[model samples]
Target: MNLEKILAISGKPGLYVLKVQTRTGFVAESLTDGKKITVNLKSNVSLLSEISIYTYEGEKPLTEVMQRIAVKENKGQAISHKEDNAKLTAYFKEILPEYDEERVYPSDIKKVLNWYNTLQAKGLVTDEAPAATSTSEEIAAEEPVKKAPAKKAKAKKEE
Candidate 1:
């Protein structure tokens, strides 16, 4: 469910995974086609983690919204975004009840649904909780293991 590297580049179809950072910009691999492309720094690239949906209470992170959709759909593909606007809006309403109807347009809903479907197809969206070992493991991540220094080899005398 990690959307940290997922990006939605404007003018680019489907989602992409951030690959490498270059001097001028960065390289991204398209999730739809598995092809890499370089994008300039001036390009409009939106990280999925940073994107949020307008809600009545406030702005809800797109990650949480996507997770909700995954739960609702049991981690399966959701309804097609190509469907009619009314049906898309209704489906979106089910996913986010407090979504601001005025601020969130049909196009936006379509994008969200489309992205969710793509992620689900790639097996990124999941409803199951992450597994943890031990009964009282309190930490979210385990500490990094330290590596031992390499031993120096003795130099052989010339014979």
Candidate 2:
């Protein structure tokens, strides 16, 4: 359920996976076509991991919303994003009843469904909860060890 490197670039149709960072920007591969493209820093970019949906009480993380969709669809593909706006809104309501109707537009719902389906097709969507402790341990294992710098010894003055 880690969406760490997944991104949504404005003016782009589908999602992208962040591949590498450059001096000016970063390289991203499209989720739909796997084509690599270099995006400049001025372009609008949003990490899916940081996206959240507006709710009546508060904002809900995109990951949690995606996870709920996974459970509702049993980790299968959701309804087509091209479905009617009314239908899409109905479906989204069932998924998140508290979603702020005024704030959460139909287009946003469609994007989420479309993104979820894309991830599902890639076998990246899972219903299982993320293992917190294991993830921390794995991160620790992946991190390189840092060595302390040697201290210089003081020079003794002549007696």
Candidate 3:
């Protein structure tokens, strides 16, 4: 479920995992194949973490959309991206009813489905919810704290 390291490089064939950082850009290993390549700043690269889909309310993060797909499919691979445009659109609609049809294209839908399948094949998709960090207040309530040693009574300066 860690999409931060996953990326879509423009003109690339499949998903890639961001690896070492370089002076100009960074090294990325193709998820389809273990091939590693250097991606420069000039190369158009997008982290899956930063991608989003247009929705009626606003933009929905790609991760959230992927999660929805996982839930709907019971953590299995989604429909093949190779499916016809109509089918893809319908499936996407079922997952995200509010998706902005005007802004979201069939190609975009295909990419999402493809990505989800790729992630699933790699065993990256999960049914369990992401672990949530407790807020400061919640943490404080859960753990008891010992009182700080009373400022050592200034040793009686009775000299």
Q: What lDDT does candidate 3 reach at residue 95?
A: 99
lDDT against the true structure, per candidate, is 0.91, 0.92, 0.92
Give the per-residue lDDT digits (tens) of candidate 2, residues 19-113.
99999999999989999999999999999988999999999999999999999999899999999999999999999999999999988999999
**Residue 109 in candidate 1, Cα distance off native in Å:** 0.3
lDDT of 2: 0.92
* Cα lDDT tens digits for candidate 1, 16-110: 99999999999999999999999999999999988999999999989889999988988899999999999998898899999999999999999
How high is the lDDT of residue 157 in model 3? Answer: 67
Model 3 is weakest, by summed lDDT over 10 consecutive residues, at: 124-133
Off by over 4 Å in 2: 127-159
Candidate 1's TM-score reads: 0.80
Winning model by TM-score: 2
TM-score versus the correct structure, for each prediction: 0.80, 0.83, 0.80
What stretches of model 1 exceed 4 Å from their correct place? Answer: 127-159
Residue 135 of candidate 1: its Cα lDDT?
Answer: 42
